[model samples]
Target: MFKKAFMSLALLLISALSWGQGNPVHFTVAQKQVSPSEVDVVFTGTINNGWHVYSTALPDGGPISASLNVEKAVGAKAEGPLRHSGKEINIDDPIFGMRVRYFEHHVQFVQRFKITGKTYSINGYLEYGTCNDEMCMPPQSVDFNYKGNGPKDAPAATDETAAATADDASPADSAAATPAGEAQDSVAAAAQAQPADTATASIGDQLWTPVIDKMKAYQPDTEGKSLWYIFLMGLLGGIIALFTPCVWPIIPMTVSFFLHRSGEKGKGVRDAIIYGISIIIIYMTLALVITALFGPQTLNEMSTNAPFNIFFFLLLVVFALSFFGMFELALPSSWGNKVDSKASATTGLLSIFLMAFTLSLVSFSCTAPVVGLLLVQAATSNNWVAPAIGMFGFALALALPFTLFAMFPSWMKKAPKSGSWMNTVKVVLGFVELAFSLKFFSVADLAYGWGLLDRETFLALWIAIFTLMGLYLLGILHFRSDGDNPKAQPVACIMLGLCSLAFAVYMVPGLWGAPCKAVSAFAPPMYTQDFNLNKTEEVKAKYTSYEEGMAAAKAQHKPVMLDFTGFGCVNCRKMEAAVWTDPEVQKRLNDDYVLISLYVDDKTPLAKPIEVKDSKGNTRKLRTVGDKWSWLEQTKFGYLAQPYYVTLDNNGMPLSGSFVYKEDIPGFLEFLDNGLKEYKKR
Candidate 1:
């Protein structure tokens, strides 16, 4: 009997251990009533030993950091992001080629709440993913609750044991002063940690909401029309066509074709007119189909969706490689061949239209990249009609040249031949496509909190790419079928060499932690660098929470530097890595101001209620910090674009004429200095 009991006990222990290893994430919420007006709520998470949780400061392209969502409650305002205190682990990520800081041990996230009613209860769920070293566990949401007394008696203020112990004073003094100090500290910390009050607001909160609302209000319902986006798409399409072999050679051929198609001398005008209309219809139909498939909501979702962005990056890279002559991308010949056969059999007007359609089909290899680029741009634009409109414009531009030249075939003599220059244009566009692919990768990296595409790494990649491109342009490199042009053309050669030299010069400072402001939005945060001057003080400085920063700003009567930046904002990264690194700029930022960076792309949700007026002017509670800041940015700034810098006084009034975008480092510093001076004068 004893032996059997021992074996059973051992088996039970083994089962228990296995169960613990597979345990789902568990969350607990502890509440301490500070006063009638405030309460401190602490969120603690317990994950299985092998599992890890991401920090709020997860770099771009990493993982979905933990977020807190508080259900709506009456008369209570939750104020701030979850503040984590625990063990930290650093790991080098391959994508960005940098170290990413994260939390491994059990983590505690603290948030404060201010009560406006007589009584209330805090209710919310902690949302996060558990990842072991090799793979990630699916994200889980665990519900938690904390009951609280109403404002009637003004709940007794309680000081943290640490703070109380540190006082080392008599019980009487500690009781009276410690409670007040703790309350004050809690409030101050809450204010500072609140994402809405921070200098840098998240992109979703700052730019997307307002722009989306504006687009919605203006269009109300974008069912069919291509709208403003179509124009942009068309412009890009036309520019892209200027480089393709099919389009370049056909420019002159089409003009002659139109002239021949037009029977009478003056009748050439009619043929040109019909051809242009056909092109518009074809591209517009394509755009319409895309809009119908992916509406505004999907577009918005895709912008921040990590997996989708990664796929897009890979797709573009493949397209770019194909363009660079790794392989040919061709449409099924059946479609174009059928159109070509019809073109030969049909007569007059029908034949002309069929021939135009056939030409478009045959040139799919050349136009596919442009189409893909436009579709991606339109999908992310938040403008439903942008794709359709852009395609229409592109098609119109392409057709217009053919029509106009046909009307006056004699002018064909002025058209440039499809020669070595055409191939050069293709190569240039291939490089462009390659560069843009990185942007998508950066987005995915930032969204996933992966540090694979940080600022320096991005710049290094660009430097290498541009260097290679310049070398190729200068005839130092050759590809398959590359003609033996031992002698380089003076103008082309000089321009290529000079551009290469300039690009190399531009990238040199980036290696030593210089801000390459020109391309900030495309790069990662400057803070990711191991040797960045901007990050040095940031690391050593007593990193105050957003709530603490706000309280200090309020007490000091200092203006707030509202920086609406993002992990994936190329311009924002560029501004920080390049412009912010300037000596004069660095000195001013460090000395004269309180800097707050609000990453619009940050996935971490706030622990409190984010109330803001929507485009309709109705007050709405924002569930995330990104939403609140996005509303603020749109309502306050006329523009919806980012790298938005706003200087606001203690009361949050925009310091008169204080706003900036990328590449305005000098202007931005001057603006901040001037605001400081004016505040002092006042």
Candidate 2:
């Protein structure tokens, strides 16, 4: 049941832009005088590069097909069904998962009519759908008006002239006529071509002032905060490493070696500081090497790449099993020995650097997995410097104790002794690693369209892993490396075990589709659950189109919320699950504001493609709905990231500033409150 729900939700989310103000198909209407009482109405369209106009003979449930509608005809009787001419290509669309027929670059439609009066007029619209590889535009229509006067008492054409006329007729006249079944459908579609609603036209006429400058004031510190987060994660990993058996024992040994090597306390402290700095430099150098090898763009791709994510998932699982004492994973013993000997033979800064390298090699068994996890996370950040910054923080945390112990040697005696406790810590981390390994697998599973690790499955695994961890911590579970006395658990370990048990219990309700906001960032989306108690339909935007939504907002006298988001954006989901789930935020979003969620990754095309310039002044074509909104976010607010929120008045002027991905409810409440206040002021 959960698997079916996950597939349905994934399909809906995955199925759900284009810029610009350029019409993908430019239409021209011309009248070809065929005889004294007959004429051909030719509609020729020049489609833009990369854009395709669907054929009139398209299968049902496919894209909008080309059709000619005669809404009004004066003294003219329709003779036959409209005929179409174009190089129609039939191809299977991988994205839409359907076979479709469409025309590229050019197409033409012609309808012949029998004229019964000297003066006649015809007015109609040509409707079709256009799309490119990136995005699809909404159904588009082009209005065409034509008037013609037949010669007064004109003579009938001679056979030569008639033959010439037939030869010179538009290709659409000789093109394959619409099949009998589709011909009636085309006529019915033509009958439905109505003029634009006056009310919608008035809304379109309302001029919207650009709010880029106003929004610039509220551009949050995106990059700085992201790097800071990566650094903190690295630092936390390093601190965890300090409790491991391999690194914890060596800390006292390394500090004592530095202190004894120099009798003067100042010299020992200085040497230790240098050694810490050396460690930082060595790790940073490794980070740089990783950055150089993969590069930022490659790292970003690897983050979502199925194969890459799967490989990391397996690697992390192996690391977890090693932590559980199945086997030891370590660097070559010879490498550590060589580095230690080099440090002994060298002197000054080089000797200290070699000593740091030796320590790094020796502690690889415990440190490598942590560093690998850090690197994997940093890779997903899509920033070239993230790995280096994370490494700097990790190394700093790893080295801080060494420097401090050398400066105050007496403090070293107070440190916890290396014992079975260290092994216990390692085993607890193994549980953590096991839990986190699923996260990587989930990413791959999602990308590959594998429903194996749906929300319920993921939560079940996490609950089981953490429950086992809690049992191990409470001495209820035992491993080969565990201390002989199972009941001799420390108070701190017991507390941690209880917390883990509590957390596991907390996730139990999530299996039933409860909004477990705490773990939303790590778990699959709520839609993946077969039975969800929390209904988010009420919070979803009532209107998706910008113009339609803004028009409604104006009528309702409410502020507009331009929610710049994406289907695949993890942070956007986090914001929705965490912050938007708050009562106040939900109230304001539902009652006070008109939400227009613009998905930057939506593949649905625009009604008509437009040509515009990006920030870099390059000519860009808006082909899809995502492209259109993404362009708007970049051009109007100078932002290209997801989960961007901005409040605006009906006329589209900024009411407040823009907001990015932040989970702080109070801060977001302030943002919305300010927008309401500003709206009321004006």
Candidate 3:
């Protein structure tokens, strides 16, 4: 019986380990107001036996470090910086084969602030990572809020209630601080007496704000998503360009040249087949080399780096100008010319490959920018094979036409000739490139807290770009040709007019303060708008004080939805416009939810301690609302970009199977509804 019992216990241990594998990390936020002036924010992480949470401070080359952000009321001033207190654990990581120190069981981070107003609310989230002895789970975040009232509103003395709440210790008594309570109260009183003027200042008013805004503004909007979509977009772009004037004329000429060189339809067909394969191999190789060099982590880091974003913005602008006929981007003719000469001199497979390479190099002026754009997009994506897959799709699109036309040479007469219309197509794409360039600039602005471009400003710029593009399409504004005459073909005219009108309509609502939800991702926060229809009295009343709402959420045991979104996140806007509009999805989110929309790109700074540890493990004091959320996203979710949604139970535990993306709106809602059902059942 003893042996049997021991065997059963061992079996149970193995079962528990298997069950824990699917469990997510536990994240909780506990806030204490040390004084009227200062607040202490603590993040308590409980990892399963095998899992460990990294410290706010991590050594170089480790996974993302923990981070925090606080949103304070106007006139409040945060005192000192955020500090971490806990027993740090040292362990040897098998993955890196190095010893690393982190935290487990429980850890607390504290920040002190001075209040400047009679009343104010502080809000933000904690960003962190969870990894076990094995693999690391995706980074995640949990929202937190704390509110304080001024001395004038101190509660009347009540012996019974005082005793009941006596368990609450002053922030100063906490192990993290020696005299935290008195220091915090003094700061709060000072803030209340002389409200800080920094609240009203634009982001440019501060030096550090610009740095944070720059990082936020320039992050790539599309880095982590389905690979199929990236490849499909490239393929579609290629197909559309095939109809452009630059390459259309070559279709027939190239086929005729091959027919003459081969001397027969059968031989011409075979040569065309070989050329198509050669094109695929060449483009795929280029994509492979890029992926092999950069890797996913480096590519993801590039998505948020300010300098990279600025460079990309400038690069796209150059491409746009080139497309508008400012100048052509051509490869040195000597290289392609030499390859062409060799192809003529040689026969067989080597000749075929050389001829294919020559055609690609020779067409650099027309296809290079498009290819470059596609490659850049693919590189930023999460999938390792995305770049290669996208290039393969693009090459296929470019090659299929050549191969098909070769097989059916008699149908060549029906093909359209290259003409002025090709210039129009190039110019239209230029407008698109110019518009996309702004997105990068917006990321830089938000990351560094620069107030150069707000939601309205970004929308206004897009409106102008699309409006001008429409006019150009309708022959209103010509680059190479004259006046707005209706000389263009009927189909092209209608297509241009409709596209222009649609985009213009989209921008019009934005000016009026509509969520313009469709493009919310790319726009700045709605709060950044000088006027907003969505910010009505009803919305204001939903959460009058952070404390009350937090208490209620805790009592009810409902998962909180902390939405780190931005108006400038094109993906966020797309989600609002396309996904959230679905009736079923909308109802679930609006009715059974505690939705806290925290705009990471907002230029508004908090008056109190929005202190967070950056990915590097240094304490970062947040000045703007964006800084808080951005830090939270990076530290917790291991994500630096926006339109991120996180759900946590009242106790701050993430609901089982609760993480979701905007694209999976239906799934997201289902996940929430299922959680609600489970709660109700309990």
Sort the predicted structures by lDDT, highest score first: 2, 1, 3
What are the Cα lDDT values of the candidates? 0.59, 0.71, 0.58
Per-residue alpha-carbon lDDT of candidate 3 for residues 1-682, written as tens digits (9 for 90 to 100): 3223322322211110112223356766786777665566677666654445666544433443565443323434445444667787775542233455567666666655455556655565665555532234434556777666645554432222122122332332222111123323433343354323323222222211223333344333443445678779779767766766556777787778788888998999988888888888987787776555543444543455456667667777877888888887766778888999998899999998997788777766667667766755664554567767888888888878788889998778776666666767788888888888887787667444456787788899999988888877776677753224536645766687678868777788788676565676567555446655543322111321122333445555555665655422334544454346545656555666566555454434467756656546867666555566566555544555445555545543344333434345445556667656655655
In order of appearance, the predictions have TM-scores of 0.59, 0.67, 0.57
In terms of lDDT, the best-performing candidate is: 2
lDDT per residue (tens digit) for residues 127-230 in model 1: 55454432343334456666656667644433222322343223322222111233235334645655554454333432232233332332223334435655
**TM-score of the candidate numbered 2?**
0.67
Name model 3 segments beyond 4 Å from true: 1-225, 481-489, 537-590, 594-656, 660-682
Q: Encode model 2's per-residue lDDT on 1-682: one tens digit a residue.
A: 3223222322211100123445567888888889878898888989865567777645533455566545566655556656789897776642233566778788988878776556666666565667543234434556667677755663332222233224433333222112223323432343254223413422124423356787767667767998899999999999999999999999888888888898888999999999999999998887766455543335544555567678778877877898999998866688889989988998999999999999887888788778777877776675667778898999999999999999988998899988888888788888888888888898777544456888889999999999999988998899987746655889999999999999999999998877666787678655456666666543677665566677778889999988886543445655776568666789999999998877564445457867876556877666556666666666666655556788999888888797766556677888999999999999
Cα deviation of 595, candidate 2, in Å: 3.7
**Model 2 score (lDDT):** 0.71
In each prediction, how many residue pairs overlap at the backbone (N, C-alpha, C within less than 3 A)? 53, 18, 65
